[model samples]
Target: GWARLADDPKALARLPTVAPGATEELDLHLSLETRLAEATAGETLTHGDLYPFNVLLTPDRVVVVDWPHAWIGPAHADLVMLLSSVALSGIDPEPFAVRHPLLTGVEPEAVDVLISAQAGFLLAIACSVDSTADPRLVRMMTELGRSSLRWLSTRTRSSGRSKSKG
Candidate 1:
């Protein structure tokens, strides 16, 4: 269940520092503990951890390798993950995400919650005190966390600056 991805209280605390205006909207959705399972229910089979490292593209076809994070959930989940990674690479994913078929049909608030959950998860990771972890990894997580929050803020405020692809 997506409920397993609940925000850690400490990470939740850090959100106001990340984006003050977005948290009230985030908190409203996050507080609905029962909605996640219902919201994510879908026939689409999604690779819950779909990032670039798990995908390989050859001259002919694309291959997805990792399966550990695979799950049956909303079609938007994997795309959102990928677009979030796109943000980490310094691209603005909003232009693509707003027009994407999968995301366009999803409730905007639902997507916001997923983005917030990721922001929470990644920021919590950035806060972890494992001395052996690479400095680069910690830095990447912090950057990704901040980017996701910014994206969520943009989404929550404008219903996205980009119009639907329809």
Candidate 2:
């Protein structure tokens, strides 16, 4: 589930080079911390980790595994992580979206926002895990962060432009 995110043209176009100690990581972490704190304060559900590897599929049903990263927060956060991981595996998220609409809720844009934030947090964590030794993880985190930043930047710019026009 790391292929599509790594291969997406738009995502790649916006990808930034791997630069440890950069401002982008700092901003991303700050934003994530804010969301995490808010989620912790309010009503929220946890997932630990919902990657494909942890999902056990049978002919009749599917079961999710793992329970380390689990935390109470907005359900959208978990959904975003699941969908993003699916997308990364070069799979179409639309099918999953259709099957489990409740997982994502009504706001598609919010899904994007959540995914961007999750990616940033994940990237930061990945960077801290021996980034110098694992070039692949380092690259993945760098790209993910860049993609998240680009998406956030676009959202901000669009919102600003709309406000100006109003």
Distance from true position, residue 72, model 1, in Å?
Answer: 1.5
Q: What's each prediction's TM-score?
A: 0.73, 0.54
Runs of candidate 1 exceeding 4 Å displacement: 1-34, 160-166
Candidate 1 minimal-lDDT segment of 10 residues = 1-10
Clashing pairs in 1: none
Tens digits of per-residue lDDT for model 1, 99-124: 99987768776776577667666766
Error of 1 at 73 (Å): 0.7
Candidate 2 colliding pairs: 1-88, 1-89, 4-88, 44-73, 48-69, 48-70
Kindly provide the TM-score of model 2 when superposed on the true structure, using C-alpha atoms.
Answer: 0.54
Q: How many backbone clashes does candidate 2 have?
A: 6
lDDT of 2 by residue, 92-150 (tens): 55567547856544444444446555665555454345425577766665555554444
Candidate 2: where is the Cα deviation over 4 Å?
A: 1-16, 19-35, 39-44, 90-100, 103-113, 131-166
